[model samples]
Target: MVFQNISTNTKLYVRKGNINIEVKKKATGDRIRRSLGLEDTLSNQALALSIQNLIEKDLSINAFDASLDKYIDKCIKVTETPDDLINLTSLWHKYIEFKRKYWSPTTYANSGLVFAKRFSKLKNQDLRFPQKIQQELFENFSLDAVKRSCIQIKAAINWGLQERIISNVKWTIPNKAFEQLLKRQKEENDINPFSNQERDRIIEAFKTDCFAREKGRHSQYYFAIHFWFLTGCRTGELLGLQWQDIKAGYLTFCRVRSQTNVGEVTKNSLKQQHSRKFPINQQLSNLLVSIPKSKDYVFVNKVGKPISFSSLITCWKRVLSCLQIEYKRPYQCRHTFITDCLKTGKLSPSEVAKLVGTSPAMIYKHYLGAPENIDVPEL
Candidate 1:
């Protein structure tokens, strides 16, 4: 049953299936006071009009309905109440908290928290406003910063849309702007792998140098460098490897150790979830056999703990300095190995990808060059 009181300025009270709901009238002075619990000394009309303006600004509602429960549900669905307005900062925090369950500590700290903090300064801004977002991007951020911020902002907004905390809206970086960023990145990025001669020189230095041959720290550095060049495994994967992962002729890359802001953390799976077995060559086998298996990890530090990527990099830099080789990051070892494998012509592109735990498409796009020997048909 539904009925309205003329004295109460069209306020409707409905009762259906034992549910009673009171639908507010046209936000009158007394109604505003009841809703707000304001002091009696204030001008009721002025306060009511002020509240009406806020309601008009924040909410979109149809005319008052006879069904009070339906009206209340509709109000809950839309931004009809002050509490219903989505706070961008709050939503971002919620998104980050939700993502922590799935994302690694490094990812959560670097991407999720970084974006949340960046956007939190604009606390109450409506993320649905594209112009405001664009203004924020330009005013306070550089081009590179804008690109990174956009990635996180877009992800958070997509999550909000999926969770129904945000209204569906077109939020995207324009194609032209993104293209410019890509151009900038391409200009900045340089992928240079060591040549065969350079690889040989580096290896020889690691093997023969008196400092590298010394008992404790030097031995660990030498072994790590040789293993990296021979196996083409990522530094994290190599550090994460356990003695049990090594079998008769192959080593399984099933886990990774990454350095997060907190410290080093071990993940049970590799990047891309592509665990693969790499065959051990003579050099690698000899190195493994010489080292004592005192710890679960194949590679460890002075205290018998897993060595970090940063520490490995320090050792690599020292070796490079001693040999006077042109500076290259340790990751170049992976690239060098891939290039050498491709140049040999013994392994196909698919085989290289399988060994490396990546896709054939990646090998073709990034590592493989033109064929050296294409059979010509006799005409």
Candidate 2:
């Protein structure tokens, strides 16, 4: 290829064999060319003169030879800023904008966006200070919360590096800190399943309470509690249940309803995506048969909508208060069921996992230590 001065203005030409390629010099083009130690001038005549000087110098050297395209690329690299050197916040914003199209609103709020806001002050800082941010988060938040934040931050950083929006660096929580956080979570979340006596008291209280039985009042509260205790379904899964989900002798857990800041949203699949059939016991089957199916849902409030989780918890608290029983989350019904199933010795850990749309590892890890042995001899 041979460089040829075609015009006294901002245009030049390179002849490759019979083809002449025209190259225009814009302000950006001139800057790039200058950064590559080539000619850059205000007027086209001056720029042409500078190019002529370069050509004469190259001829004199008889060693330096490169195509105009290759020289332009080299100039671009010289003038462009490396992605890794961009501010941390700028990279996170790019990541967040990209993720907004793909992630659910609730997930974005709960994970990436939330982490972004928490560390907004450090947005202008470099990603090299990830360890410092991790330490700060661990000190300020609960172990679980910290773990979640770290995961989001790490994911965002990894994505930025992968997309070449930021530099690759070690942005992981230290192994020791992560292990300590896991230990704290395990210690804090130690399963506290209700005993058989406590379970009996709760059921009996709910059944006999006048407030629960009040005509045209929270009557569904009574049945809802019973349904939860009977099925051991997650509160959201039980509330999400529809009349159509009930088959002849089993119920299909295919969806879950969770309340978020905006409103309630129904996920089409259960947590862990482990939707399964839960066989209805004789008592529960009888109870289902007796209830009037006035709405699409198996359980509904007075306004004919699926019962809210808060309402269920309020009813449970009232019942617990009436019975003078100690407070336990409504979720303990699930633990109670798993413990009862394990005590019966009729179902294996894997079987219980299938029944509740959970993992066998979870069942054994949490419930196997104290199986309800009804046959144990009295002291």
Best lDDT among the predictions, by candidate number? 2
Tens-digit lDDT track for model 2 on 1-379? 1223333323343332222223333322431222223332111212233333343344356532334544344323322545757544445555766787786645544454445445543322456777677667667777777777667677777887788777657676754677774774463365567777888777666666655756545466667777777889997788888988999988898887887533566777777774778888899898888777866777887677777888778878877777777788888898888888888889999999888888898777677674573357789
Cα error of candidate 2 at position 265, Å: 1.2
Error of 2 at 37 (Å): 43
Error of 1 at 326 (Å): 2.5
Expressed as tens digits, the lDDT of each residue in 38-136 for candidate 1 is 222112212222233234433345343343333234322322323245655556665776777798755765566456546644423576676687677
lDDT of candidate 2 at residue 181, scale 0 to 100: 48
Query: Residue 149's C-alpha lDDT in candidate 1?
Result: 72
TM-score for all predictions?
A: 0.67, 0.68
The lowest-lDDT stretch of 10 consecutive residues in candidate 1 is 40-49
Clashes of each: 0, 2
Please give the lDDT score at residue 350 for candidate 1. 94
